[model samples]
Target chain A: MNYNFHWRPVMKALPELLEAALLTLQVAALSMVLGVLIGLGLSLIRMHMKGPVRWLATTWVELARNTPALFQLFFFGFGLGAVGVHLTPYLIVLIALTFNNAGYLAENFRGGFKAVPDTQIRASRSLGMTAFQAYTRIVIPQVLRIVYYPMTNQMVWAVLISSLGMLVGFRELSGETQFFASKTFRIFEYFAITAVIYYVIVKIILGAASLLSKRLFRY
Target chain B: METTSRFFSGFTPNDLWFLAEAAGRTLWISILSIGFGTVLGVFFGWALSVTKTAGTLTIAPILDIFRSVPLIIQLVLFFNFAPMIGLRLSPFDAGVIILTIYTAALVSNVARAGIEAVGMPMRRSARSLGMSYWQDMRYVVWPIGLRAVFPSWIGVALGVMKDSALVSVLGYVELLKASQILITRTQDTLLILAIAGAFYFALSYPISLYASKLEERWSQ
Candidate 1:
């Protein structure tokens, strides 16, 4: 109740914070792209492949899903370093987020794949479509539609989890906020602004996602 | 061997004891938060369902703020802000308060969906049978709604349990923080992390498996 509130320092740092926000978006978007690609591959392998490969994919999905994201980031940061595989903080966060995103996205893709009936694939094949064509044109699009909402959610999750970059010393939005807050000791003002930035970012993502869904899924 | 001795100390049995105690704290905090959160969430959810427009205007947006922001940021903000407002809260207290609210925000949605899943006709029938409103809720709505949302509730609970790890950021010595301390002491990064991951998986995997199985059985 006695502490004086300061907005001036926060205002001075706003541009840098916004710049860091872009970095946050960039890393999140990159991770989501890589995650979706790898997730799709892992789901397909789990569906079609056998033996060690499928087991490896299952292990990846389960580990990602079951453990906390921060733990995974720490593993990438220090655990790998222990084995002499050094990574920059940016790479650590990127790899960790990608690892988490791919795991969760793989499960969503699996469910999506299952939701597409076997008969549809068989019918496409019977109509003289090649296996590749049956999958590419007939199945994948439907699976994408089924998974579109979850993918959007995962994208938001990637953005939220990227905030953990602060702990590893990566200068994402939260990290930059932490940096300035420590210097100015305007901890509340700095984080309060960061939270608003996050809220706005989330709203924009949801808004764009809904609009995109309209375009992509319009029947 | 020489390099190993220089860089890595033996992970003593005491470290295992330390982790187990920290694991207990993790469970205790999660349980406390989830318990309080669920009660508050169920009330909020009931209110949201019962008073749609008013609830949407008031409660829903506030709850949405909790949902939209990252938990870590929320933790940092609340931890820093509390002392400024003359509330002398410990990290543990602040962590619990914030986590409880976060959990409630999530659970409120699940609870509302569960309530909605119990159709109007079902409740009407109970009322027609001369049951009082509270009686009808207790007898008809509660059981059916619980079953409908049980898996989702489990998902939220497990999610919160994992998310409670974020509380470590506030300097609460939970399982993850304990392992960090151990890693620093032993420099056995891989070993300690593996053990911590295993502890998490052990706690999480069985419950998730059971939830999925229940969901499948319920769907059938």
Candidate 2:
């Protein structure tokens, strides 16, 4: 029990660790953008498409949601490498995270779609708009609004899950913390600092989301 | 494809059973973690539901911190730091302890919300019927609140199972860790990884389906 707490090593590494935290945020943001698009596509395919195409959509959502993201990351990275399709660790995490986020959010978006009344779409259709126009102009807006908070939740999840990048050697915040912690032998201090950073990053995302929602959702 | 073909040479069928054992470890750890969480979660949830004292205010912020951070970071921190604090913990012990803390945080939220969702009028009506506090809760609040909470509890259970994968990083030989070991040994990443994913899917899908059925039945 003679362990002495030291913060000096962690203090000196703040700038470097903060940069790594920013990288974590960047990867998470990029994944969120990709995930939303893929999720929307999956939801539409599951809803409107038929036959094998729809089956593919259904399978991706089920498999992704049911499996651990770590498993998916390894499966995508090494699995592809097993087939002579190598990917960088960065690409591996981005793709795995995007796919995972898409799978979860596709289901969320599907529920959002159900929550919207069918009459809204029919009304837009009868107003001389094409089916595509009706969906984009009328239905999609409502779906987006309905899923906005859940989208924020997914964004937070994507940020947190990106820490798995550490395992795959992507050098995000957690990876960088491990690197510094081992080098300085200040394991507790290094991890303690990064945990605070993660907490702050999540708070910022939630804060920004609420601020943005205040504007977009104001009636 | 050639790499995949070459990988077949090092692979053995028994690795499937090895993974099955690992999957069993994953489930075992999940049950222990969630079990611990349920006990503390109910206490904290009940505390948060009743805003009677300074204790509730203090506990709320502490729970909020646990909820905010990633579980992986928490797991790694606890595993690495326990030695410094002179507490000896095996990787499995450390993993289960930290995950239980995280799970309890989430479960408490579920409990608090579920209780609130039962509404005050229902509680007041039960009180007017001359039921004691314990009797009122046992008869009225528990039934309604638990029904509302059941669906979300299943979601948390699924989440805890996946989060358990993170314990593998600390050298706990769970399903994900077993997959990593197999990959390094056999080099058949695609097959190994897919089988691991299938194991997880098998574990979670039925729980989700059953929860959905319960939700539907309640509607009926």
Candidate lDDT (C-alpha), each: 0.95, 0.90
lDDT (Cα, tens digit) per residue for candidate 1, span B18-136: 98888899999999999999999999999999998999999999999999899999999999888877898888999899999999999999999989999999899999999999998
Q: For residues A42-69, what per-residue lDDT tens digits would candidate 2 score against the true structure?
A: 9999999999999999999988888888
Per-model DockQ against the true two-chain complex: 0.86, 0.76
Q: What docking grade applies to model 2?
A: medium
Question: What is the fnat of candidate 2?
Answer: 0.79
Question: Model 1: which docking level applies?
Answer: high
Chain B TM-score for candidate 1: 0.96
Candidate 2 per-residue C-alpha lDDT over B1-220 given as tens digits, one digit per residue, 9 for 90 to 100: 3445453346687999999999999999999999999789888998888875664678887987888788888988898788877899999999989989888999998998888878899899999999999998899999999999989898998999988999998899999899889888887788888888889999999998898789879867
Error of 1 at B181 (Å): 0.7
Worst 10 residues of 2 chain B by lDDT: B1-10
